[model samples]
Target: MSNNIKNIVYRTLSKAWATLLEINYDYRFKDGTWKRISRESYDRGHGTGILLYNVDKGTIILTKQFRMPIYHTNKDEAMSIEVCAGAIDDNDLPESTIIREVEEEVGYLVKDVKKVMETYMSPGALTEKMYLYVAPYSEEMKVNEGGGLASEHEEIEVMEIPFSKALEMMVSGEILDAKTVILLQYAQINDLIKNRE
Candidate 1:
């Protein structure tokens, strides 16, 4: 509630790529005590991710790209396999953003996308809520050679792998991205793959 917070102050630390804020606020405890706290939150805005599956073929589309953060952390391997995703810019809806992302990142124009779930990716420090989706696709959906937007410095490699193999990759630690894993597991749990046959 608004009454629980007081003396809130926000300082911008960076605004180049995304906005980062250092926030200080006073909170009222359950015992009626006030405590001041300081925290930093990175606000890059909310985004969406979609797992493209071909039930008939038992395959899913994934994208491979170089992730700078992962490169810095791992030192050797930097390319990450993940579902097609992007941030919702301006006032665009999450579903619209994901549909555009799917086209741009994987070259697929999909209809009948199902909203699976929405979750906060990193609640501890970052403010990002990701909308997850799944869509059934066929070869006719391919409209262009999707490699992402070069203007945004995106060099994505599109990959179509068997659903079973993707699950194995998750167990083998090859698919490390949380959203990708969650969507993959969702497909399995919902019997989306099995029903395709």
Candidate 2:
């Protein structure tokens, strides 16, 4: 607790699919005055997302799936094109979670993935720190059809698109997922693919 903030309190609002809590706190102003405030925080735990690329093929693996939250905002276009990702779940490390997710979500059993960065997808209300990564992939690395798991009701469409096209999609507003966009930009800025023309 910082000196600027004090008298913290938490109350559970919901404990379904994810946990939601209402937090009340008192803040001290620079002028020596204190004020109380209330805010709702949604704790869904942390997750990971990875950008699987193939320099030899000049392409990248992405996933297209229906997002209910997106549907809530824009019903006309609820399908989102994004990097393969999932909740960290019981995995002890973010790296392990992403590795397993890559195989289960995209059918690629990638062994080496370089962590690029981590970000809070939505810090204002959601407590989800997304571990972003980039990994090299090839046909030999694929083990299955990688459309996500049926148990989770995930109907993910695997897309192996040219790197340039992925960039174009980012510009065309087709790839609106923040983690996907950030990873794509990271690849571009870092020249992760050399054969991309």
TM-score of each: 0.95, 0.96
Over 4 Å off, model 2: 195-197
How well is each residue in 1-197 modelled by candidate 2, as lDDT tens digits?
A: 39899889999999999999999999998899999999999998999999999998899999999999889989867999999998988546999999999999999999999999989988999998998989999999989999999999999999999999999999999889999999999999999876466
Span of 10 residues, lowest total lDDT, candidate 1: 188-197
Candidate 1 residue spans exceeding 4 A from truth: 195-197
* lDDT of each residue in 38-152, candidate 1, tens digit only: 9999999999999999888899999999999999999566899999999999899998899999999999998778999999999988899999999998899999989999999
- For candidate 2, give the lDDT of residue 10: 98
Residue 196 of model 2, lDDT score: 66
Clashing pairs in 2: none
* lDDT agreement with native, every candidate: 0.93, 0.92
Which candidate tops lDDT?
1
Q: Residue 58 lDDT in model 2?
A: 94
